[model samples]
Target: MLAEQTIAPDHPVFAGHFPAHPVVPGALLLDWACHSLGAGQSAASREARFPRSCGPGSRLVLRAEPGKEPPSSARRFAITTEDAGTEVAVVTGTLGPLSTAAGT
Candidate 1:
């Protein structure tokens, strides 16, 4: 399954995150990812990774797949974007219960 988001170039977070050279906070990315993925329980286990920097106007593409090997209720996801013609992973982790319809 796939979900995507684009950070606004004028997003307010840029102001405090770094006035000179703004970079989207990893927390914000995680929040957006959880919401986009329809996470059912906020208390459930979750994690975020910063493999690369995300700036304003950057497009975040989320790809989700069923848990590997076991087919459990848990789902694996990754937020990535195009970098130098190659896809770069910005955040990767497992999500909690899904609140909405399942992903394909």
Candidate 2:
């Protein structure tokens, strides 16, 4: 899966993170990756690494790639992002058991 997002300059988090030079928080980026990958139904266990700082108004492209394996209750996904050709962040982890109910 691929997703795109932009951190607006007026976003509230920037004010407290830094009044002078604002950057998007890593936690928020991780949350975005989870949502983009539709992992809400599963208990996702992941770690994120930020190699570059992303400031306000930066356009980010997120990509989620599945591991080379068949589907199962636990699944691995590699999530990464880039902004204007520069790599920004990467997250890798496994999703917990899949839900059988609808709309999970």
The candidate maximizing lDDT is 1
Query: Each model's RMSD to truth, in Å?
Result: 5.4, 5.4
Error of 2 at 60 (Å): 0.5
lDDT of 1 by residue, 1-104 (tens): 47787899999999999989999898787777667766634423344567889899898898887655433656677889888888998878776554322332
lDDT for each candidate structure: 0.73, 0.62
In candidate 2, position 59 carries an lDDT of 72
> Candidate 2, which segments miss by more than 4 Å at Cα?
69-104
Which pairs in model 2 have colliding backbones?
none
For model 1, the superposed segments whose C-alpha errors exceed 4 Å read 40-45, 69-71, 97-104
Best by the TM-score measure: 1
